[model samples]
Target chain A: MVPLSWYLVVAFMLVGLGAYGMIVKKNLIRILIGAEIMGNGVNLALVAFAVYGGAFSFTAQGLIILVISVAAAHTALALVLMLMYNRRYGTVDLSIVQKEEVA
Target chain B: MNWKVKMMQDLQPVLDLFEQFEFFLIAALVLALAYLALEHKDIVYAVFFFGFMASAVAGFFLLLDAPYIAGMQIAVYTGGISALIIFGVLLLPRAQDSSLETFATGRVRTMGLILSGVIMAISGGLALIFPWPETIPEGVPEQSQSLQGLAEWLWQDHGVYIQIIALIILTTLVGAVALLKMEKAEAMSSITGEFGVEAKPSPEPEAETEVVDTEETSEEAAN
Candidate 1:
């Protein structure tokens, strides 16, 4: 079996890339994708730790499943919000704020 | 030698592949896909890449021997969430330029890159330095091999979490319906006010849409 540390390194890289995308992306949907990537990194790390240590492996998997469901729920709500924003403002760009500009 | 034995011999090297190399390849594929997804200017392409990333993460779970999680990842993230993202993309209006405007440029890009790099270095170094326990206690059981134990765990010990998640899903369903409903109830109230009728507030968009469906209510409100 390979050492556990390598998995951690991979997860770290994923988180870094996700953070970069989140910081740089202007589109709301792209930003959400970045957030999803970061969540995946966290899930990978949790599973890796559980697999290596053996203890809490079941719990870890359960929690990961929960995280997936919660993320789905969040994505649904976020997409609806994005749709609402698009309908209201006619664009999905994050640079525009209605309170400051319209009111 | 028999044909089966001959085939097995031929596939021996492939079957005996080390986990390390497998890990490396999967990690590389996942990272590459992630980069592509993030860098893609087209929202639809990025959404598809996101699905691929989720599928790759499911592969990682399989490598970890968590087959249940791998299946769930494929079903939920790759299948369901990707479809939702695509629908959102379809609903979005076409940009005049066809190119997404990104704020991640110049000074901001430099700062983001530096910050992410430092974070990755620190986390990687810490992981290497930390002494993780060598093995898990008495190996995870064979019975827990699939999702049997997970199902039991959810019902017996973690039932509350299941209920809570169900509640969250319900809330999200209602909230989404409200947010995406064809005409805001607030806008409807303004129309009602213009017609000089006392506006009945409908907090739920489902109700508002239903009311709009009935011409009588609208006519009464207008009158």
Candidate 2:
């Protein structure tokens, strides 16, 4: 069996990448990408636990599906927000657009 | 050298292969695609690469023995979320001028880099320090047999919560349509000669000045 530590490490690395993306990227869509990365990280952790803990039953599967669906729903909302940002500001940059709004 | 020989002797080939190759391969691929999505200049392509990365991650989930989640990942992420992101990208105006310049500079980037460095350091430290459980616990219920039991529990114990989540998703779809519809109406109002009345008034002032100058010429003709 694959060790739980290995999966945990991969999840951590992915989460770190997501954090980096979220911090470094200024574009609204890019930030959404980072957020998706973070969500993937969480999903990885959940699946890892389910497998490692020997809890890979249907309830666990159902919960994982539920989480995935929720994430998809959230992504939809974020995309809508990105569209609104692009429309109102004519630019996707978080900093420039916010500056314009304040001014 | 001796320890390596003993370890190989004890471990199954499948586990060895997973540890040696597949895990790292998927991890590297996911991280690389995520980096590309964030660093790429074009927002449209970033979204596209993100879709690829999400699907790859779903493959990883399958390897981790979570088939249900793998299906959901592909279905909800690659199919639903990615499609929505692409639609949003298409709806944006094609003009790219000034957008790149707005994001490429300033203190925010510097701060973000610093924060990411700190987070990476912390996560790395945690991974190193935490000792993972070596084996699955004994006497735990077998996963395959528990499937029917889980189904019963889900329906009997958590059915209400599942229904609520379904309702929330439905509401979100409705809300997104309503929001987009309002924006379209607003855009139409702004463009269709209704909101540009101020722009026409400046030309009207110039026309009035011309009319005043032509008034004497018309009077001469009348006389």
Candidate 3:
């Protein structure tokens, strides 16, 4: 059996990559992609913990599904926001929008 | 001798191979695809890589024996979310504003690098240092049994949560409509060219010049 720590290690590494992407990527859509990466890492870690810790309650599984549903909703809303911003400002570059607002 | 049996025999080795190295295989795929998704210059490629990453994550969930969650991951993240993101990418006027002069340069790039590194270091250290439990607890529930129990729990034990989640989803739908909807007047003007300020006349007369011309024409006509 694979050790639980192996899963944890992967989760952490994926999360780190997500954070890196979130910070370094300037495009709003890319930033959202980074967030989705982080969400996947979190889901993996949660399932791993539930399996290994003997806390394999039904609630854990249900909660995981709930999280997935919420993530979908979040992605929808975020996409809408991005579209609105793009329509209004004509740019998705965060810095450019900030500059426009300041001027 | 049957083809199905022969196919199963052929797949058995592949399954065994994956069972042995599933952890490493899925982890590497997830990380590599995630990096490609984030770092790719073309937004379209990044979106495709992200879909691949989501599928890889779903595979990882299947390896963890959470088939239900795995399916959800595939449906929601890999299919729905990826499609939505691609649509958003298409809607944008330009892919990315990565011009030579203004593309993440100087202090911004340095700061991003530094912050991401610091975050990774902190999280990596914590992951290494945490004293994780060594033993997998006995009596872990089987897959089908767990799925049944989860349904029971959702409908009986934690029923309210299901309702709450549904309400939240409904709220998201309504809120999205509200946000995306233009005012009636604005929409009407946009549809019809009557109030279109964006489409100004090519040779618009100056207000002062128009007034002076009308006065001169009146005087000439009166004389």
Interface RMSD score of each model: 2.8, 2.8, 2.6
lDDT of each: 0.80, 0.72, 0.80
Relative to the true structure, candidate 2 reaches a TM of 0.76
On residues B38-110, what C-alpha lDDT tens digit does candidate 2 reach at each position? 7777777777888899999997887866665677788888888878877766655332233543464567677
Which residue pairs does candidate 1 place in steric collision? A53-B136
Query: Candidate 2: misplaced stretches above 4 Å?
Result: A57-59, A101-103, B1-11, B94-101, B134-141, B145-157, B183-185, B189-223
Looking at candidate 2 chain B, the ten consecutive residues that score lowest on lDDT are: B190-199
Q: Return the lDDT, model 2, position B125.
A: 72
Q: By the DockQ metric, which is better: model 1 or model 2?
A: 1
What share of the reference contacts survives in each candidate?
0.75, 0.59, 0.61
DockQ per candidate = 0.50, 0.47, 0.48
- Model 1 residue B33 CA deviation (Å) reads 0.2
Residues A29-57 of candidate 2 have per-residue lDDT tens digits of 66777888888887888787777675565
Q: How does chain B of model 1 score on TM-score?
A: 0.69
Give the TM-score of candidate 2 (chain A): 0.88
Native-referenced DockQ of model 2:
0.47
**Deviating ranges (above 4 Å) for candidate 1:** A98-103, B1-17, B95-97, B134-143, B182-223
